[model samples]
Target: MSKALRRTFVAATSLLALLAGASPALPTQGTFLAPIAEHHHDSSLMYGTSSNWSGYAATGGKFTSVSAEWVQPTVTCTKTDTWSAFWIGLDGDGSRTVEQIGTEADCSGGTPVYGSWYEMYPAYPAYFNNAVHPGDHFTASVTTTGNGVFNLTLRNVTRNWSRSIAKSLKSATLASAEVIAEAPSSSTGVLPLADFGTVGFTNAKVNGKSLGASNPSVIDMATKDGVTKATTSGITDGTAFSVTWKHS
Candidate 1:
């Protein structure tokens, strides 16, 4: 094979090896350099508003699982840098810890980029070295063993690729289960929201039950000053809903 073709073959082999747990984690790249943790705008809520998150969360339980499906939304990028992530996880509502995995659509130097990642909060996310694009169908889940062990899985059905990782986080409180579309954060604070139009999430489940049956709290993303950024629709069919971006 030519050098370029050989390099392509090597990368494809490496990604397969990594996804199958045959290879160790690689260095971070693309727009996934920093930790992406939940940054709440309203700490307490009847139905809350967050600076970074817009989705449904089931609280007041020992939430052992959360799973959802979404099509990666295409981002409309400008010269401005922005970030958005869709994920399902446990904790980070009333607890300090979060075990999450999902995909991101971002803007860098006026171009749109897509990627997948999993993170045990307080640590940086480990990205999956596979191509992701707008309109790729994805299903992701984060589940715990009721002890400290977790299983984080993401599958891109459109591309026929999947990754599942086993992890442990003793500090996780199992306080809440959530499926969220968020403007991911940096050390400074919540980053700008990407113009992702709208993303529909389906088959939302918590602990094997439909999320709508869990009395999930609906969250809308807004600024500290009360400027709305994204709006979440009511759950339908006991399993589906959508989040629409409203502002940066």
Candidate 2:
């Protein structure tokens, strides 16, 4: 994370992005919107090759549940606007639907902002009124409660706050499970990524099995041409991993 290396990574990522016909990065602000597409443009940073995803994913199983724990990162708004989200979700690897819930840390007007929300793909995500801030401990889970019905839950261990929502998606394929730190999408495209320093996830599991037991893919945020967007640490002790900010 040195100044020279960071600058190199950013320049290379930006060049590759321009070559890929991507739009120039926008100045992101306000609350995250429910994505209009089933997949976000930032899926390039994901690790798996199952169509769409940039996070660790387990395929070939009827993934019943996925969970992970992370302490909020201290985000800094060195620039005017940027965005990032941390969440656990099911589907969206080989399916059109994604069931997800987590928190967002956004840099708006050079100020760090935080909040929590949930999304059932193809529908708009809803933000919860519960407070979220840097250093809060969070545990989030997405469960497939049979027949494409899902139960999503998120808890703030430091605040004794939690929220759960149950919804049904009859067409869900249950193809994959994911734990992700993302540059969330909006109507325009992928938003400018926030500088979240580094965030670590522990006790990551799918269907009650650790990530190693599930044999999921390890993902680093990069484009097809090999320019780094973010760097992900290899899975350690089956359950822990980290994603460090590289470039927006």
Candidate 3:
């Protein structure tokens, strides 16, 4: 071939090779970063309202009253690309009391069991101060997982309340709010289940979210917006409850 023809052929081949390298690669299955799962629960009878309780246990002591509220969303994902956060709203009557508001990744085993959980004390006086009371409002967040589950549980433990007090309290009412993200786990790469649950209180309502049984990639206890605390009051019990996972 002539020198000019040879040069043109070489240039064409080089351009083709460059194009091949520059082309975007196809996204692999399970390789894409899924959106953070979101869920919310709200009270149907009352707008942001719930029941309460007070009690005592052999281990804790001096139990008073306990109330709670929560929300669960309907989104699913294997893991989050970013960190997860939770938000909540709280209120009550009587003296300013300390409330323990927390989120857990795996709670299928029950409370105080330490089954891969993350928690936060949103009350005004820290656990160290030991001075929290009713009518308190605050927000909390938990990024760590107990074992590696994507489950989130919000429990409002009173400073002086135990399982006994949780049972005797009357005229108890309260509200709980929550939010979560699709953030990646620090301990492991897998995300926790999106299912969630709450203890104490009556007439609970979960809003701004949906169920996860229909989604294949999403897990239970995964919330995105955290909890909200508005129009809440009263108390009934101190028992623990949860939104159990149902995979089809």
Candidate 4:
């Protein structure tokens, strides 16, 4: 075989081998790098708002991958020491674990701090060495390469920095996939949410298809009582979408 064909054969065989193996043991806690341990507030509402999350989720099937492209929003911290994250991932919808990667646009001491990160939920998030700035175009993804194994990739297209991680988690069910903007959780509770103005996610896809083709669930973030935090624009051209922040 030619070199390229040989490599393809080896990769295909490896994937098949992995899928045929027994599932790995679940981790003690979800693995997402963050300042403190906090619950991820999620949503399934198609059109509305919430205090926690605003994005698209594809449910009702065993999803293998999720990805999105977005230009990082310029954040103005109306309040100090606030937090928010924009990310794409698999699981964490109806499952106990999440494999997610995204960026943070936060306020520290009333100043804006921008950075990138990846998490396997319940675990604190880990930051990337690459510098992040407002208006940087980013592309991120989470893929389940096989049973209990995942790959997370994040790229700062504007800055030309990228990171990829692969690991195994037996607890992951690959039940759902998402692209979201959130008020990060903390040990005390959900942290103070930052005022991130507006965030737009474009070219969203699931299992290598446009979001619309996957029949995704539209979610609007809100408080526990259903007070809207942010509103999502309907998917355009089957792939592009936007989220407008309302209250912090």
- Which candidate number would show the highest TM-score if scored against the true structure? 1
lDDT for model 1 comes to 0.77
Better of 3 and 4 by TM-score: 4
Per-residue alpha-carbon lDDT of model 4 for 39-67, expressed as tens digits? 23233333333345677777777889999
Which prediction has more favorable TM-score, 1 or 2? 1
Which candidate achieves the best lDDT against the true structure?
1
**TM per prediction:** 0.85, 0.80, 0.21, 0.79
How would the candidate models be sorted by lDDT, starting from the highest?
1, 2, 4, 3
RMSD of each: 12.4, 8.9, 24.3, 13.6
Question: Model 2, range 1-248, lDDT digits (tens) per residue?
Answer: 12111111111010001111111222223444442223322322323321112357666678889999999898888756787878888876556677888887778788777777787776667777677779999999998766878999999999999999999988787777888777765544556678899999999999998977886766556644555566677788989998888777
Residue 226, candidate 3: Cα error in Å is 23
Q: Model 2 off-target regions past 4 Å?
A: 1-29, 35-54, 223-226
lDDT of 3 at 15: 7
> Model 3: what TM-score?
0.21
Clash totals, every prediction: 0, 4, 92, 21
- Which is better, 1 or 4, measured by TM-score? 1
lDDT value for model 4? 0.68
